[model samples]
Target: MIGAYTIGKKAVTFGYKRYGIPGAVASGGAALAGYLIVRRALKRSTNADATGVESAIDAGEVKSAVEERGLGAVTESETLERAIDEEDVGSALDMNDVQSAAESETDAMTEGSEGDSSDER
Candidate 1:
């Protein structure tokens, strides 16, 4: 038992002083390098359309449509028109929506505080 304990103590001391910390650091660096390499490979493989712009926009379909309608064209093509319409609708949050959301949040806070007050009483 003493011999085993002495062996274990020496092993632990040597490992702590020499190999263990360096080995752990090297392993961590290798893992990080592997992760980065895999991430780069995945990104490259999936980047068929790197710009991420829609085919219609990339091909100048919107410009051609506008040109066909003349320089003073007020009407957009269906594709461009729909895209603009979507953007407008998404951005057009009215004051009523904000007021209702605020009121609901205030009501919830008041209700929670009322419950807590009753519990204290």
Candidate 2:
């Protein structure tokens, strides 16, 4: 009976050891596949960033050239036309006037409230 039990245990151990090899291979394959995918994605992102920086430098150079040539030197249909568009300084001053008027009215209301409370006392 003892000998039979020992043989049964050995058979089970051998079965597990055989299957373990395939399990290890599958794990290693998955890890390697993930590494390759991530490496490819990083390379593509780096290339896109380099291209964007180059384009920005070109845009800055064009703007600088327009400024140096004076507004009259710029042709009528160029991008410089949009850059030199007039801003309404008068309307900005009107906004400040409106804001000050609002603040003065609020101060008056607070003073009126205090005067009424004093009269009641």
- Please, what's the RMSD in Å of model 2? 33.5
Q: What 10-residue stretch in candidate 2 is worst by lDDT? A: 83-92
TM-score for all models, in order of appearance: 0.26, 0.24
Off by over 4 Å in 2: 1-19, 48-121
| Model 1 lDDT per residue over 1-69, tens place | 112233334434444565687643443333322222222222232332322212212122222332244
Q: Compose the digit string of candidate 2's lDDT tens values, residues 1-121.
A: 1122332343334434656755334333322222222222222323334323222222222233333452222222243223221121111222233223333443454477689999999
Clashing pairs in 1: none
| lDDT (C-alpha, whole model) for all candidates | 0.33, 0.32
Worst 10 residues of 1 by lDDT: 50-59
Each candidate: RMSD to true structure? 26.2, 33.5
What are the clashing pairs of model 2? none
The deviation in Å at residue 85 for candidate 2 is 44
